[model samples]
Structures are given as C-alpha cells and as structure tokens.
Target: MDKAYRFEGTYLQWLKEELTGWDRFPWALFGFGVGFQLAILLLNPINWIAVVSFIGIFFGMWCTVAMGAGGYDSEGNRVSSHAINGLLGSISVIAYVIINVSAGHYWSVLDQLVFLFLIDLPLLKNWRTWSGKSTEIKGLTKMGWLYVIVAILAAWFVLYYVGIYLHDTNPLWDALALAIGGTASWLCFRQYSTTYTLWLISDFVNVLLWFTALKDGYSQAALPMLAMTLFYTATAIVGKINWRPNKVQ
Candidate 1:
C-alpha cells in the first residue's frame, strides 16, 4: 500500500489529483437547490426574500463544493470549476433579491439541515468515493487556516448576528457564514486533519444553532438546516473511516 502523504505543504499535489477526472463528477447542486425551493414553498412566509436568499446562498455553496470535485466538457477539456461556481454564485444573487422582495424570515435550523445532509452531503460523499484519489492536502497554508478560522467565526458570528441585531433583518451575516463555510469546505477537501475535524466542529455548531433557532420560536425554519447539519456530520464520519491515500488512479 502506498504511504499516505503527510498533511504538510501538499496543497499543490492535492490540487493536481483533484483537477483530474473532471468530466465525470456527479455534482449534487440540483438536489440542494430543489430542497431550498421546496423549503421556501412550504415555509410560506409572507416575506420570502430573506429565506430565499439564505437558501440560495446555501445551495450556491453546495454548487461550489460539488463542482470543486471536478468536471469536463464533451471535447474532454477541463470545464472551468470557476465558471460553474460563478454561475451558481450568480443564481445566489438572484435568490437574494427574491429574499429582499419576500422579506420572509431566515431559514429555520431544520430546513438548513435538510438542504445540507439530505441534498448536499451525499454528493460530497459520492465525490470522495468516486474520485478515489487522495493527495496530500496541507492545512497550514495561510489561506487554508484562514478558511478554518473564518468558517468557525462565521458560524459564531451568525448566531450573534441573529441575537444582537433586532432591526437588521437582512440575514447578511448568515449569508456570510454560508459563503465562508463553502470556501472553508473546499479548503477542507484539500487537506486531512483539518478536513474531518473542522467538519465535525462545524456540525456541532449547526446543532447548537438548531437549539438556538428552536428556542427562539423559529421552528419552521429549523428543519432543512438541521438536516444539512446531520448530513455534514455523516460525511465527516464517512471521511474519517474510509479516507486513504491513492485510492484513485
């Protein structure tokens, strides 16, 4: 068996292995997007803008992670992951606008979870398995570590944002959390120790958020978020148990 490369200064190698096999990655954006739309449909808030924005950003990140795993075109050229990410990002903007128009409440905890684990987690797990290739992903890079810190801070900040700012109902902080979370998630995929551990920590944070949301009487918004959180937890478990070096050629 090939030795698993230690997680030290190996981002370049990981990037290479990750960039290959672009043509056949199964991205799970469609599922998450669908879930978000349904959440909005069911939550049925008089003001739907905030909820839609939240869902849109969440799913957009979903697109970022799924696409980051890789893709290719008919001619076999590498399809730009950036392009896919950009397109999804644009959709998120439109969703944000819709949220402003709807002026609905933020997504509930359970709703976030459903979108995450149910819709997004499987895609990530499948990507890891299907890729079957593991390269050394170091977590020490300045940007990499920044992502980790930012992800945690983002989660924490959103909670505080919800609690402290009674009038600023824009949900911008939560959007920032999702954005940072998505970036951090991709960075996590590039490494090992930080990858699994950070995800577990993030899952815990989500659970905490669920409690907070529920206690505050936002139970209607908690379902999808909680679902996604659980899915993320499951992904962390699978990753830790099954992760190995060079499983894919």
Candidate 2:
C-alpha cells in the first residue's frame, strides 16, 4: 500500500476502536456534569451566554473523563483521546472567552485565551503523531522539562502582571491554576502519566478560584464554573489511577 493509504487505514482503525465500546464510556462523570449544570441553571438567572459556557464546559468534562477511562495503549502511549480532548477543550475556552468578553470581564478573557492556546499547541506541534500518521510516542526529555518550566514561569508572570496592574479579582489563583494546568497539558501531550498529578493540583486551585469568585460576587456566573472545577478534581484522580503504568513482570 502507498504511504497515504496506509496512514488512512491506521487512522480509521484507531477511530473505530475509540468510538466503539459504549460500556467503556465515562457515564458517571458525564452525568455529574449535566446534573450540576442543570441544578445551577435552576438557581441562577437564565443567561444565554452562561448556557453556552455550560455546554462548552460539558464537552471539556467529557474529554477529561474519556481520557481517564481510555488510558494508555499497550505500548505505554496515550490513546487517541488526547487529540479529541484538545479539540473539545479549545471549544470550551472559546466559549469562556466569548462569555467573559461579552460581560466585560477582560481578565477572564485573557485567561481563557491563554488556556486555549495551551490546549491547541500540542495539536499544532504534533499533528502527525496525534493524527496517527506517525506512531512515535515521545518520552519526557530534558527539552520537554525545560518547556514545562518555561510555560509555568511565563503563565505566572503574565497573570501576576495583569492582576497587579489591571486589578484582576484573583491573580494569584489564576496564575497558579494556569501555570500548573499548562504544565499538565504539556506533559499530557508527551503521554506522561504524571500529567494527572499536575491536573489534580491545577483543578484544586481552579475550584478555589471559582469559589472565591462566587462568594465575592466577582461574577454571577461563577457557580457553574465552580461546580465544573470540582468535577475536574474528581476526573484528575480518576486519570491518575487509570493512567498508572503497568508493573513489570
């Protein structure tokens, strides 16, 4: 077979495997996200933008849960869920940015835009590998570690600067969440199981961030986001367990 045909076949096969097996679906996580959104909607004034944001967050939750359940393949590489996660997460960030901007929450818009870039970077950087055109799975090298450090530092500095200069509600929480979360994304792209640990840390910070926002009346739409971050924390634990490396005989 020609290289193009071979690549197509492999990609199709991977998709087939990923899409089938309904029993493997993370129904509990999905249900929690849906139920939480609905419950919050009942309590809050119906804002169309908030509804759209909820939808985006739901998809993002789906991606996270799916990645946790799918885990890695036999060769110690992540399943194709990483690519799908990136796509869904990008959509989620766009929704967040739209809502924040419409509400004149420029700080949140900045934060979401940075997150969108982080989520999409891997897809752009490793299209061939993620698309199954290449089966190469990268190990965390010195360069990868360096990348993570740089990302964290950059995220912190930017968020801190904005928080101090622009009077953001909670710059420290934003900076910590994104710094760790961005590192997690980088580790995830490299298929490192340790990504879940960083995710756990990030999610906790996010939960606190949103909780503070809701309590302080920074945003009336913070309830759903707070709930979403709580679920994210749960999924991080699940991902950590599911992504555990198999023991050597």
Candidate 3:
C-alpha cells in the first residue's frame, strides 16, 4: 500500500485508492459547502465568533461528505467507508465544540462528550481494516450493537439532564438529537447502510437545534447553522442512495 500523506504524489494516490469510485458526489458537495459557507461569512461580517462558526460549519460539511462517501451498506460492507466517516466525524466534533462554546450552546457540548467515544474508538479500531492492514473484526458487529444501546441510553438519560441543568427548555430535542446522532454515527462506524436513514432523522433535529439558536437571537451564528442544515439534508439523502442494499455495487 502507498504511504498516506499530503505530499504531492502520496496525497493523490490515497485519494485515488481510498476515496475514489464513489462518483463525483463528494467533490461536488464539498465544493458547494466551502463556497456557500465562505460566501455567507464574506458577505456578512468578520469577527472571532463568526470565524469560529464558519470553521465549525466547514468541518460539519466535511463530515457530512465523508460520511456519505464512506457510507455503509446493508449487505455487510462499507465498514471501510465508515472508517473515513469516523475520522472526519472526530474533526467535526472538535470544531463543533468550539462553535458551541463560542455561541454559548453549552448543551450541544455535553451531547458531544456523550458521543465522543463512539466516534474515536471506532475510528482507531476500524482504520486498520479500511487501510487493508488487517482483516479481523471478530465480534465487531455485536459490540457495535451494544454501543448503540448504551449511546442512546446515555444521550437520553445523561445528556438530557445536562441540557436541563443548563436551563435549556429544549432538553427533549437535545436528548433526542444526541440519541439519533450517536446511533447514526455508530451505524456508520459499523458500516451499516441504515446509518443514512438515521442521519436523516438527526439532520432534522439539527435544523431544529440551530433554529432554536436563531430564534433565541444568536443571529451571528444562525445563518451558517441554517446553511449546514440544508447541506446535511442533501448528504443524508444522497448517502442512503449511494450505498443502499440490493443496489448494483
């Protein structure tokens, strides 16, 4: 296998080998995301808060495309794709925490904490498999299922209270978002096609989450949040179609 790096030839090789054959969907979506978010930031204003929000949104869009590109199918494949998903998701999470703290969306931070392990642990374990360095995944599916249950429970029981403790009235939505997001991320990590279906649900909740922020007068952060909402919708829908079960592979 070619060594993976950002240097001239190596970067191109990794792209061709690991991220090719998914059609031009990821490229187009990535272009749209960067252009749209940059336009939003440029046309409006420039401040530290705005910069952080844009950064968060950029990574958010990246994660969306990565998840779609690395989508899992119901036919017990795509775990390789899911590896990329978790890698990108981890970056998105860190950027998102910055966005949340900067925008005073503390509740979202708590939710991220709850799901952190779900993303990172899988990324570490699955990267080798995706890179063709290993082929052993004994009990991975069963362990993933356990994570699903534990994640949702943690999202609902623990993160739910965090929202309440923060005096947020929308704790229910927060909890549900975490539950869905956590499970959806897990499914992607496990290379399950149903992950996209779950992401659609989470995407809707994410829209609501930002809508709440916009409604609460965090306008500086709202516009980009709304833009991300639309991008995520497209990603989730396309992801489902791109790697569906029984589809021609």
Candidate 4:
C-alpha cells in the first residue's frame, strides 16, 4: 500500500487502542442540552423551523462536547464528531437564515451565512480524512499565520461595513465574532490544535453578540443561540486541554 494509506491505518489503529480504556461520554452535558432544546420546542410548538433548528443545535452541541472530551464509536474508532457537528450546525443556521429572512432581518441572515461557512469547514476536513487523505493536526506554519491575518482583516472589513453602514445591529461584536470564529474554523480545517484557543475567544465574542441581540429584542431565537455559545465556550476550554500541542498528531 501507499505511504499515505499506511499512515492513516496506523493512526486509526492507534485511536482504537487508545479508546480501549475507561472513556466515558459526558451524559450530563448531553442531558442538559436536550432539556434546554426541549423547553424551547415546548414553548414554540407551532414553529417547525425552530424545532428543526433546535434539533440541529442539540446534536451540534453534543458532538462538539464529544469531540472535546475524546469521543469514540461503538467499535472504538475515534469518531469525527466535528463532521456531525458541522452538518447539523449548517442545517441549524440555514433554518435561522430562513427565519431571519422572513422577519426582514437581512443582517442576521448575513451573519448566519458566515456561520455556515465556518461550520462547513470541519465537514470538509472530515471528508478528507475519510477519503484516505492526510488530515494530521499540526502547528501553524508561517504561511498559515499569514493566511489567518489576511482572512481576519478581510472578514473584519466586510462585516464592519455591512453591520455598521447598513444595519442597526452591534457591528463591532459581529465583526469580532466572525473574524475570530472564521480564523478558528480555517485553523480547524487545517488540523491545528490552536483552533481551540481561537474558538474560545470566538465563543466569548459570540456569547456577547447574541446576548446583546436578545437584550435589544432582536430575536427571541437569540436566547437559544446565546446558550449555545456559552456551551461552546465551555467545550472550547475542554478542547484546549484535550488538544494541546503535545497531544496532537
């Protein structure tokens, strides 16, 4: 077999062996998320889109926590929970976009669109890993740092212009959240452990973003999103610990 295949096989074997020990799932966190989403659903039983978004949000949150805490499948294979999270997150954001569009909140639609791109990166990375391609986590190279800088600058400029000039929304918070979160997503796609650090920063900014939106009566949907960011912030801390440089491939 080719060297790439051999390497991937070795990696999978290592993961399987590593997961053979006492690896317990975080059922408490999962239960809490389920309860939270169910409460939202009970309150908005007629809003099917909200129901769909809640389903997606719950799975996305669960998978993100699982990934941070080192998840394994029934067969002991390391589960690419980010892939699942990304897919469900995309669905959730799409539903949010529709909701925003119907409410004439074009800026919120734009925000959700950007979020879709961020989450989809992990799905792309997972596809590469599953296709016998290299998806090894590594430290950022100089070029990678440059790319991040450029991306953040570009994202900030556009988000600032759109959010400030066109909408009455919190522009700075939106810009910061998207810029940092986009960087984190790109780093994640490149398989860098440092993505967790960036994600931690982004998650805090996102909490502020949605919290302010809810406070200003932007959308009642912001409540669940705010809670989601808080959960993500906690998981990002877990990911930082679990995906430290020494532990990464």
Question: Compared with the true structure, what per-residue lDDT tens digits does model 2 show for residues 175-232?
Answer: 6766787677666655566678778988888888788877887676678888888888
Per-candidate Cα lDDT values, in order, are 0.45, 0.64, 0.64, 0.62
**Backbone collision count in every prediction?**
38, 0, 0, 0
TM-score of 1: 0.42
Candidate 2: where is the Cα deviation over 4 Å? 1-17, 22-25, 71-82, 100-111, 121-158, 246-249
Task: Identify the superior model by lDDT, candidate 1 or candidate 4.
Answer: 4
Q: How far is candidate 2 from the true structure (C-alpha RMSD, Å)?
A: 5.4
Cα lDDT of candidate 2 equals 0.64
Candidate 1 residue-wise lDDT, 1-249, digit = tens = 114312233445434445444533233433554565567546766344436645665755454444434344333533223223333444544554353233332432222343354324543433323322334333355675776676656665665466346443334434343434444455443434345555565567556665455466544445554555565565455444433333222
Clashes of 4: 0
Runs off by more than 4 Å, candidate 4: 1-22, 43-49, 72-83, 99-135, 140-154, 247-249
Q: What is the lDDT of residue 91 in candidate 4?
A: 56
| Cα lDDT for residue 119, candidate 3 | 61
Cα lDDT tens digits, model 4, 100-125, are 55434455566567656755544545
List the pairs of residues colliding in candidate 2. Answer: none
Output the lDDT of residue 5, model 4: 24
